[model samples]
Target: MFRKNFIMSLMENILILFIIASVFYTSQSLQTQKTIYVPQGSITNIISQLHKKGYEVSPIDRYILSFLGQPQSGWVDIGAEKLNRVDFLYKLATAKAKMEEITLIPGETALLFFEDIASTLDLDASRLQHYYDQHADYPEAGIYADTYYVPFGINEEQLIAFLLKESTGQFQKISQKIYGTYDKKQWLRILTIASIIQKEAANTEEMPLVSSVIYNRIKKGMPLQMDGTLNYGKYSHIKVTPERIRNDKSRFNTYRYKGLPPSPIGAVSFDAIIAAIKPAQTDYLYFMKNRQGTHDFTKSYRTHRRNIQKAR
Candidate 1:
């Protein structure tokens, strides 16, 4: 009889243990992903909140964190996002935050284009312009036109650093490919010529012809009487008026000055830059745009004048 009673008591204890194990398993099985936001606050408070939101925050975990260190203020995805607390913390501390992107327009002046970037990123327009001016050796012509992805909430200083690094790196790579060295003065001169090519050409297809005309004029020591040179600052336009072309005394006036401008007039495109490096091998000295939305290349002054008369 004593043996049987002992066996019954042992079975009851096993049943009770099984019940407890089942309850624990049920609770743990209910786990699901949640998007938790850990804002900037006291570390202890943050951990406590993390526990309430279903993280396995125990005294041992807290002790481990005290030795391992905690991450800075940022949103961490944990406890249901297929990541443990440790994994989430490590990523939050080390990895860059979520990214946002914007595209820089080709041929737009950095001073004006930066404002558009500022508007897109919700940054101060003046501050953006100032950053470009301060960092870029070539100012408006320094930055490469492309889509850029930056970390969310990145400050102006960080953005400027990124822009400088990328622009310099791209220039170095392309310049070496084209000219065999990163010649600062030569690169600047090429950009000066490229900027004119970028503006004068109706499209990428027309850039080479326009570039040839500029080079031809330079070789002949004839004044580059291209009206595109007058398109700058407040006077920027497609068609140069007779009054402005003749009367404008600005140094940018190719009608008055004999060679390339003091600097690039605006940001230039990749094709325009290439066109400046390798111009079409034509004897063309002048270009006049026709009604077909492209320019007509002419080798003689008489022919250019005849085309101009026909257009009128």
Candidate 2:
């Protein structure tokens, strides 16, 4: 009878100890991103990835997660930076990330791009610029000109960081594929040429021809008198006038400057970038817009004048 009483007392102690441990585990804190990319996998694999990513997850969390439900695939909204262990586990299983689309057209300036984003995403323009200034490696073209589905409700800093990070990765990959290396200074010069081609080329097919004209002019030490150079920043959609060209003193005023712009005129397309890298083989140094709205290429200044007169 005494032995039976002793066994009951030990069982009670064990139950109390288990309750204390469970309470402590549930109260543990987990730090998380506002949105996290959860891979498509079983609970064990998800937990493993979380652990690998420096989260305070363990094998035991897999058992807890199994009871909650299957974790969502793709991006999951955690909704908070810090949460108790139980809440974090529940969110991983149930919450879905909300996304919105943003597009930056080729030849658009970053100034207008951010304005569009501010209107579409309900974000502050100044804050976006502040974050961009803080994190971007370049003043512009830090983000690729393409459509992106970003998580909704992301703050300015996170948004800018995300775009820059993704674009830099893509830039590195493209550069590596082309030259087996990535050099920022050389790449910036290429972007300068590409941006001009993007603004001047009437169509994709005309990109290489425009690129050739730029190279020839640069080689001959002639000023690039292209009007497209005046379309930088807030002047993106504004028509360039002779008055504006004469008054503008920025380095982007290619007519006033003898070489390429100090930086890219605007965002560029893949075709323009390729054209900048590999220009067409041609001796033609002058081009004028003809009546057909396409440029007429010529080697003679006198013929170029005739083509300009015919265009008028």
The lDDT, on a scale of 0 to 1, for candidate 1 is 0.74
Top TM-score hit: 2
Which 10-residue window in model 2 sums to the lowest lDDT? 136-145
Among residues 3 or more apart in sequence or in different chains, the pairs in candidate 2 whose N, CA or C atoms overlap within 3 Å are none
Instruction: Please give each candidate's TM-score.
Output: 0.71, 0.72
lDDT tens per residue, model 1, 72-130:
55433343555554554444344434566877666666766666778877788778767
Whole-model alpha-carbon lDDT for candidate 2: 0.88
Candidate 1's displacement at residue 199, Å, is 0.5
For candidate 2, write residues 1-312 as lDDT tens digits: 999999999999999999999889978998988888787789999999989988998998999899999987777778899999999999998998768899989999888999999999989988998888788776767777888889876788988988888888878888899989999998899888999999998889888999999999999999999998899989999999999999999999988999998888788778888899999988778888777788999879999999989998
